[model samples]
Target: MKITFLGTGTSLGIPIIGSKHPVCLSKNSKDKRLRSSILIEKDQKNFLIDCGPDFRYQMLRSNHERLNAIFITHEHQDHIGGLDDVRPINFNMNQPIPIYGLRRVIENLKKRFFYIFSKNKKSNVSKISVYELDDYKNFFIVENYKIFPLLTWHGQLPILGFRIENFAYITDASHIPFQTIQRLKGINILVLNILRKEMKHSFPFMLSETLKITQQICPQKTYLTHISHTFGFHEEIEKQLPKDVYLAYDKLIIYE
Candidate 1:
């Protein structure tokens, strides 16, 4: 299996338009981030997680042949805004891409992308197929992968994380339900969101809070994502993390 970090920044992304933060002013490529997302490649098939506003750029950088499916974490705009960009791929493949997400999230996608589902509407002729998933009821399986959806909390809003084989990816989780924790046992490579160094917000898990959760999960290696400028420069933050934990940067790749 191969995993690629498409974009590792927070909702607003690292440079946040015109802010004068030092981290934002840095010229280092690692300091430059787009939005949070990833691409998983296995058996020549590509699976995407969170098609944020930077989806087009991400795809150009990914260089993958085609997409098999997209797994959404929630309905936040930063997570789904660039969904329309999939049309080109649709035209090339001559089929609608399958989108898997929670029932509530899928419904919200309809409202946000209403034109796509409407007939006789003047808009891009994009096509999509949605699959409403019950993460609590059963594990999802597709092609050569068996995916286990783990329920996580983004503040009070319930969200999902996925476990495939020995690798698990969980982003924007403020808390992990006990049942979900039970499912994560023995995961080798784990990805979790750690917003910044400070434990200021209850919505996004900060560095310390995320570390606590990492200790509990005890994966062989943990890569932190969904970073903010407040987290400091990528070069500096990379050194502070505990052994086996890493700060993921855009375009970073992992093989398993």
Candidate 2:
């Protein structure tokens, strides 16, 4: 299995518009991030996790011709904004792309992209099939992968984190319930989200809290995602992290 970090920044990504923060102003390419997303490929099957606003560019850069499915973590625009851009894939495959998410998230997608869901839709709109996921109680099969949806919380909103075999991906989580943590145990690679070095009321994990959780789960390798410019330059943060953990950057690929 191979995993690609398509985009690693939080919503209003790094180098946020109109800001002059030094990290944002840095010349390093890693510092210039897009909204969070990832691509997982196993045995020629491609599964995308989140399709943020940068999805088009991320796809172009990766140059993958086919997408098997999309697994959404939540309904936030940063995570699902680029979903409409799946038209090219729909055109290539001649079928609607399957999107998996919670019932509420699926409902929100139907409301937000009503044209695509409507019977009177325009020809140009992307076609999608929604598969509602039941937290913990259900699992789905896609090609060679068996996916388990782990439930977590983003403030008051219930969101999903997915576990595929020994690899798991979780993002935008403020509090991961004990049940969810048990589901994550014994993973080979864990991708988690950390917004900054300090805590905020907005509900993303800070570096300190992330570290504590990372220690508890103890995945052989842990990659931090959904970063902000406030986390500091990529190179400096990389040096400070524990050897098994890393700050994910756009286009970074990991194999398991």
Looking at model 1, residue 89 earns an lDDT score of 86
| Candidate-wise lDDT, in order | 0.90, 0.91
Error of 1 at 22 (Å): 0.3
Estimate, for each residue in 132-192, the C-alpha lDDT of model 1 and write its tens digit: 9975758887775888888999988999888889999999898998888888889999999
Off by over 4 Å in 1: 121-123
Off by over 4 Å in 2: none
Candidate 1 TM-score versus the reference = 0.97
Candidate 2 C-alpha lDDT tens digits along 150-187: 89899999999999999999999999888888888899
Residue pairs with backbone atoms closer than 3 Å in model 1 (clashes): none
Q: Candidate 1 — worst ten consecutive residues by lDDT sum?
A: 135-144
